[model samples]
Target: MTAQAVAATTRPRPARAWRAVLRLHQPALFLWGVFVTLVSAVLLWAYGPGGNAAGAAWRRKCTVDLCDWEDYSVDRYHFAFRFSEAAIDFMPILVAAWAGAMLIGRELENGTAELAWTQSVGPVRWLATKLTVPAALLTAGTTLLVGLHRLVFDTQQVPKGWNWSDNGTFEANGPVAIAFPLLALALGALSGLIARRALPGLIGGILANATATTLIGLAGPHLVPWKISVGDLKQGYEAPSGAIYGGEGAVTSTGAHIPDPCSGGEKACLAAHDIVGFYSEYHPSSQFWPLQLTETALILTVTALAVAAAFTLLRRRTA
Candidate 1:
């Protein structure tokens, strides 16, 4: 081919490939856009107007001596915060379903993937295109949402009954927010490749994501070594903000013992346990990045493994 012809063909190949992918997934892309827009609006409202109103009302009614309990706006903002948090928590499952059912599984089940293989694009290239395009979009969209979420969460005064260390809060406030979605995409692709059916793949992918998230949450405290603090119960000790308490127990001259919640009295409880002081093991606020990065690395490793498995499965089936 002539130089102009060759250049024209090569340039159009990538453009055409991208256009095709976008066209095929228009519905998914539209929904993703809608989701991002709604979430962004919610976060902005929470930080700007909703939070301001709530804070103003709180300051008006609350004082050292007494506080009002009849305001409904407080409850409204609280529910808004909760709803925002729940949306963040559900992202992984949504990503998994989309990646599995819509991205690859349906194509494979309907024979569209095989037909695409007969075109200029081979199976490997097709799979790579499918994986990379959606992965990039998912990463960008989720990162944007996370940034907004952090802004809303950090700027607002936390409502009563909310803890920063809550599971959804911890995940949404850090790098795990981005990593988990990537992991879900990889897992969903693998599930789709294995099941070769949209519905089955979607279900399997959701289960995989759920299992992984639960395991990580359970192991989060132990992922990084925690700090320990000891203090005399009589003297009183307070944990720092954002501390994840592993456990609190009695420390005595003889040995350590489990804490007792006795209704009788502090003296009676201490005497029964031979406890002289209290000790706590915890991960503090300073450990947040360390813990978040460690968890991100772990989830990314699993994502890599899943992606590798998917490619292997594709090669096998095509062969």
Candidate 2:
């Protein structure tokens, strides 16, 4: 073979393969760009201009006194925060549908994947390239958004309704934001490989993502053991901010019981019900990192299993 021919034959192909994957999904890429831009703009506005206006309004209305709510801008700021949070919650479904239908299922359904197999790329490399490129893009975008959200959330003084312990707030504020999308991508790829049809794969992927998120939410608190705090009812002990409230009840002679309607003062109520004090089980703010890391590990484990299953199915189909 000539020098030019030998050089061409020996050159690397992974870059070209990745470029082809990007080229194949240009529309999805464009949409992702639009989403990231819009989200960043909203967060920036909330952190700078919107937050300033709301703060000014609050100070002007309340000068060591309860503020009248006639013209305060707190509600507007709250709306922006709530809207951003809703967008973060919705991103996983989008990732799942696009990864399943556009990235893999359509190729298989239309025989383009088979055509690509005849080219320089093998089946495994092709699948890996597809998953890797999109995963990288998704991780970068989501991490940026999560950082921006934390900035805005931390700087602003929102009402109790925007508590960090809320489900959406907790997920969006931590590493779980990034992990969820990765998990959805893997689940979508696996669903696409199994279904081998575009529409069904898209539907299956969304449903699978929903089911996984729901299960995590239902089981997350149990994953890490919670702490119990006991205090006298007369003293009035309250859980710290950002603590996840498990349950609260009075400790009575008959064991722990939820407080019922007891008449009279604290001493009278205690005497009437044989209640000693109040005790509650909760996950405190100190547990945030542990819970976040535990959930992220669980999600990433599921993601790894899905990716493995996808590869196994691909190999069997093409063998």
Residue 128 Cα positional deviation in candidate 1, in Å, after optimal superposition: 1.6
How big is the positional error of residue 98 in model 2, measured in Å on the Cα after superposition?
A: 1.1
Clashing pairs in 2: none
Count of backbone clashes, every candidate in sequence = 0, 0
| lDDT for predicted candidate 2 compared with the true structure | 0.84
**Which digits, one per residue and each the tens of the lDDT, describe model 2 over residues 196-229?**
8888889989999999989987778778887877
Query: In terms of TM-score, how similar is model 1 to the real structure?
Result: 0.85
If candidate 2 were superposed on the true structure by all CA atoms, what would the RMSD be?
A: 3.9
Weakest 10 consecutive residues, lDDT, candidate 1? Answer: 256-265
> What's the TM for model 2?
0.85
How far residue 52's Cα lies from its native spot in candidate 2, in Å, is: 0.7
Q: Model 1, 238-276: lDDT tens per residue?
A: 466667888766677676645645422478777776766
